[model samples]
Target: MSTNKEMKTATASTLNQHVHPFDQLTGDEIIQTAAIVRQAKPEVDLVFNTITLKEPNKQVMLSYLGWDTSKPRITKVEREALVVILEKVTMKCYEAIVSLTHNTLKSWTYMPDVQPMLTMDDMFEVEELVLKDEKVIQECRELGITDMSCVFNDPWAIARHVSHPGREKRLMQALMYMRTCEEDNQYAHPLDFVPIIDLGLKKVIAIERIKPRDSKYSRPTIPLQQHNFLPEFVGEENYRKDVKPIIIQQPQGVSFTVKGNEIDWQKWNLRISMNYREGLVLHNISYQDGPEKRPLFYRISLSEMVVPYADTNTPHHRKHAFDVGEYGLGLCTNSLQLGCDCLGSIYYFDAVFNDHNGQPVEIPSAVCMHEEDYGILMKHTDYRNGRAHTIRSRRLVISQIVTVANYDYGLYYYFYQDGTFEYEVKATGELNTHVLAEDESAAGMGTIVAPQINAQYHQHFFTMRIDPMIDGQNNSVQQVDTYTLPYPTGHPKNPFGNGFTSDYTILKDTKEGQQNACYETQRFWKIVNTDRIHPYSKTPVGWKISSGHTAPFFAKDDSLVAERAGFAKKTLWVTPYDENQMFAGGFYCNQSGGDDTVEVWANREVQDIQQKDIVLWYTFGITHLPRVEDFPIMPVEYCGFTIKPCNFFIANPALDVPPTNKKINHSVLAHENSSKGEGPKSCCSTKL
Candidate 1:
């Protein structure tokens, strides 16, 4: 392997050559090699003769984007030996013309500058001239023309003699005189001009004059139509209704735990939480239906206590406590349109607190939530006409706020259908006592009722409900849904019953929804910090930052004592997209699609679980509402839910060893008789 120092040295040397004496030497060598380069390039040759100059029958003029045709222009003429003049002038002119043509042709051509600018007609005319090379000489002999003289005059000079440059531009004059004839309806004949030699003897290339065809003339085309597709009835509604104000209650405490290979539970409890306040007002006005048929609107405001905890034990030397709060909005619509049209905002404020010594101090708190529009659209056949179609578009808006310190705050907004917003807010003061205890009593203190976990925690589950008004009526309700503390068993699959499976099972099931239980329960977490201790001990003597290691449990393991917890064996379900599964999908499939699918599977599981198993908890359509207090700044709302373990595992059985690498290789040969084409062999085909 190459070392870092060696790589740096090589890079430095390569760069040094370009900036020092080596660069000058390289330039000299390039100049010395010009002849060799030219010899290596391809060449073409053509023969031609001088002809009389006649007025063209037709002409065309071209102009640049900003060129003015009213300005006078001067044309210079140079007199030099024929041989030297032709060599120098033709080389420069051909280079410039070829460069311009090549740049334009790059949009389509593949052979670079070799392609000619003339069209098919020009090519056909040139071919005819080549075939009649001797015939043109015979015609001149018949006309009694003997002496030959070459003429070199700018077309612009001729234009000046006939009309001012303001009337006839140089380009227009050249096109008219050289390309067409004034009286005769025939193209100009170049054979009428004689060739002249000044310094050397050399046969001249044939000169041919061409004109733009009159029938081919056309004016540029332009588009002249406009189209708009926005709905005509938007922003025409007046929504106003009265709703009651909400009073928030603080929760007693919060807790955190890591269960069996699943998510780490960060639970909060707001004891007397109100879903929605009363006496709020809303107004509704519709543009299409006038003032009478306007839609009704309502608003409710509520506050809840916030608490935050670490999954692992809190540090003994910690000086401050932290509380985190989140915001959510619930929608219940009676509109036959499925409550599709809705708008709401949430505002957050920090709580004043006293330190452990009862001294009042202004604490800073922040709240943030995903701010986006959320709605649902339904399409059905129109009863009036089975063939006619009717559609409705509903809109929901959410705004989030986050407050970090006493004065530090942030806010964000988003718009989407069925999307949730979350932000983090800080607490004003620290708690005097450590809220979390390393004992079982602390496990179920603030449990919120979650029907799905009732079977496991039974009567231990707690519940709270907040009622918020809808359209100025007591029509909506919000529920603070929480689950009981989970129990941990070191099973890799079905960690939280969220449908995610392990990498091992993912490799086995190529199709969707066929994952094994072992892979389903695994979860990943970042280990912020760690303390090493003697096996079976609770005291830590060493510390290290564990950045990327996985934490896969959401509950405490009862079987392991506090001491054994240090040595506890934890298993995480690895998703198939993990690095270890790279080769499992074969080379081609792996290259096209990678580990991004792991997040997709997790999102799918979240949606599926919300729809099927957890119906008792009412889902607040995703929103981040803006409040008056959130104007100058907003706070972050940390919003998330919890799930407790229930009938999620089976007892372990005797170990069943898997085939070894060598055995897997040999199995391919043994199964060759049953295989077709180049199919891969199964490692399990080997005999035990």
Candidate 2:
């Protein structure tokens, strides 16, 4: 109701509806809307598909609600409506639309860009329908298979695999599995089953079955009988609460200044929120000096992600997924435990969701924020003078966990003491596997995770939609690269691999924007305020965008994965910032025919990007080669990119950061009570 509360609220612009948090209809609103609809047409058996809250326009929000909008002077006006989708089940037609306004529920003329994809019910029916098919049963029986179970394919994934991207057809996908009872039973593998169902047609388009691969070749399945258990201190494993007494306590205190969703630490300031699509989004990110607030980077968030499998077999050929577009990372978020997931003075944020019946559901502990000392941010010592200096860096870790069927992914946004914004994604979960017979080659496809189960190789590609407001709004982009010097003017040039000098090119329009790409010889690009150059260097104050461990797209150009997600083809792309262009994979990627996407927008004649609003799409990913260690679950494999300050600051921004402790104490506990036991600690000036 107030500005302070608005800042704490999870809100978004109409630019991209998916970015809006919990756009799904709230339970009370659904009940009220359903009543409104049924009162008008009693015969309406509405199968509600989508019920999202329409958000205000981005321009409107920025004008009315920008710049520390928490001041009470700002008026708090509610101008939002609910976008409801009501499908008629009896006649097999979907038409009616309704909206909830300040007055009451009323008929609405607006319609969705496309018919929404499979809901949870559709996903369930995928496996249920397969089980009901007599042909499938008879074939399985004929093959002497009985104890197997089934797993549904991610609906978003099925949309990508379908050869016809723009058929204007509604579909759902699933993979057959040879279910096994783990020591802690789980449905982890994918069978050769690829079922494509056409919702409008009300029948399966096709069911393709391919040869199964052997998991035992590399991934030796450890059956319950073969599982090795450590000798128990007590027979009851669940009652291990008494194994050892331990507790997390902070004797001193946390240094983070937290208020609602905002966090201010040392020199960093940021606001975090959880959404259904992009799990976490940070806004108003800045760095602080004494009295002046310096801009480091603004609005960094995960734009979209694509995971494409390598197998070209029948169904496997269509196994790619536009994760953020097809399946929502926010929708799949898991409830995390404080002690188990993270250990410290833990602070958690709850997430909101809506049940099919349109009831509001609160997922507790859906997001976690904490501080961790990363050993040492930087340290150096001089033996000659015995003078030493070390800055033990601390980081603010904001994270959310999402489980997409068989795999668990953790999206982490990290902020360091010295103006560093790092985005890291962790993949650790059961591999999509398949049951194999005795005679099969596990070559070229995957590593065996368990006996008779092969885990295929896949690539997970991601893009970060950076809305850089570098020193205040207007900024520009430039590419810098170093070239080997042919001749040295001051002295003899090293005839060897030798000397080098830097060269740069400004990205002015769409033509020049084409030259931007990541290469080994090039240094990171700078997002700078051209109008406001630094007094010392006469160069614009800027921040550098750096890439981490990333591999190029492996999907062939003609491949479906590439055809639909062309943004993955390049390492980086720059375009004029348009609130409407929030996603790289594209809006409505569920069944996209590759019509409109980031690249499509980039292809538009480029505008003046220098000293103008700019939106950047950067891609990074990993090539997952399965290993036996990836069995039940794999260790978290982290991959991401970082943003560091270039000429943005005059000197080391973190030079004033207080060190951790000057020394370690060897004295025991009792001595800590005496005057000599005050303990060793850093005596840096604690100034505001």
- RMSD of candidate 2 to the true fold? 6.5
TM-scores for the candidates: 0.16, 0.82
* Poorest 10 consecutive residues by lDDT, candidate 1: 453-462
- For each candidate, what is the lDDT? 0.19, 0.64
Indicate which candidate wins on lDDT. 2
Q: Please write out the lDDT profile of model 1 over residues 1-688, one tens digit for every residue.
A: 2111100111111233332110111222222222222232224121111000111111110011111234442222111100000111131111211111121211111121111111112223333333234533443444343321211111111111112212111111111111121221111112222211111122223232221112242211111111111233122243334555332211221122211101111111011110111001111111111122211111111111112122222121111111011111111101111112111222221112111121222212112111121222223455675432222222222222222221221212221111111212221111111111112222332221111010011100001111111111111111111232243443454345444222211111212221211222332211110122234333221111111222222224431111111111122111222212111111111011122222233333422211111101111111222232332222333322222111111211101222223222222333365354434233223334
In terms of TM-score, which candidate is strongest?
2
lDDT of 2 by residue, 1-688 (tens): 1111111222222122323222333445556655665566565555555444444454444444344344443334333444334444321324334555543555544344454433455566565676666655654554455643522344434645446555356666666554334333233444444566665555566766665445344322222212212234224654556456344444455567765566787778877665556667776677786687765455677888888888766677677777677766766788878677766776777666444454555566777777776667776777896556667777888898888777788888888877787888898877776655545656677776666566889988888888877766678888888877867555566555467888766788755664434565665677778888888888888878777666778888877778778788776778887766878877567766566787777787656777877877888888899888877667888888888887767787788776655342122355264456554455332335
